[model samples]
Target: DAGITQSPRHKVTETGTPVTLRCHQTENHRYMYWYRQDPGHGLRLIHYSYGVKDTDKGEVSDGYSVSRSKTEDFLLTLESATSSQTSVYFCAISRDRGTGELFFGEGSRLTVL
Candidate 1:
């Protein structure tokens, strides 16, 4: 919150590992998101970017992979990590997406074994 910043808050790899999660924002909000919080599929949407580089793909985008050239940066990759894709990953930012209002980043928990 308050400018978002999510790094490797916690992680434990295995099962063809290759995880990378980093979302840093200095309030350059143009819209950037990557969410995943399992346990009943509470929060889906695994990709988003509406500015730097422009991107799309959500609703649990298969495998997951995203990047923003700049504007604060947003990256989430799991090139080859699986195990039901363990859970907990959030990085959100929104200046205005129809007033949806989103500004989160204090989560990054991955465990695939």
Candidate 2:
């Protein structure tokens, strides 16, 4: 098993409130990424970290931000949520970047009103 999990498997929130999603892994891998899946858009990256305290932004990182303070935990924060941001978020990890073979968590369903 890849040993990754996403929290708040389901969620519903107001349009303008802040929401935070958590990803936990037991694999001790160095690469962790946050992505959101929307209809017709495929998976879009929000943020990713190579190692603890080492992070970088992804293509669709406007309303989202992330932090990785520990090897096994990465957190994604929506500063001010929006209806457009309503999507299923997934956390993924890879043992190596060259292979591009990613293992994804079940996903977090977020509904915005």
Candidate 3:
């Protein structure tokens, strides 16, 4: 994509540790989202931000947190890493909030052992 970046493309950590993933976008869109993909569950939204310093939790946000201090940057953090939290995380940007069209970044894979 022209305007998206995900840091730590791959990461491995032990259980009970903490991990953070960063997403950067250059598209200047008002919507940025973080999602996790697993085998059966497919993709599930973790959090999203409509603008700077404005964010809301998603369906599976129990152990995760997100922050967007700037329009081009969004961060996702796992307070305490766990095996079940292992999955591929993706950051998406879209101009239209209700539309399905979005630009996604290269996924970040995390493993917890």
Q: What are the RMSD figures for all models against the true structure?
A: 11.8, 0.7, 0.8
lDDT (tens digit, per residue) of candidate 2 on 1-113: 79999999999999899999999999998999999999999999999999999999999999898999999999999989999999999999988789989989999999999
Error of 3 at 105 (Å): 0.6
What TM-score does prediction 2 earn?
A: 0.97
Give model 1's TM-score versus the native structure. Answer: 0.32
Model 1 pairs in collision: none
Q: Which segments of candidate 3 are over 4 A away from where they belong?
A: none
- 65-104: candidate 1 lDDT, tens digit per residue: 8889998998999899989989999999999799888988
Measured with C-alpha atoms, the lDDT of residue 97 in candidate 1 is 91
Candidate 1 regions off by >4 Å? 1-14, 19-31, 37-41, 44-69, 86-93, 96-113
**Clash counts for the predictions, in order:** 0, 0, 0
Q: What is the lDDT of residue 56 in candidate 3?
A: 95
True-structure lDDT of candidate 1:
0.89
TM-score of 3: 0.96
Model 1, total clashes:
0
Predicted structure 2: lDDT: 0.94
- Candidate 2's C-alpha runs over 4 A off are none
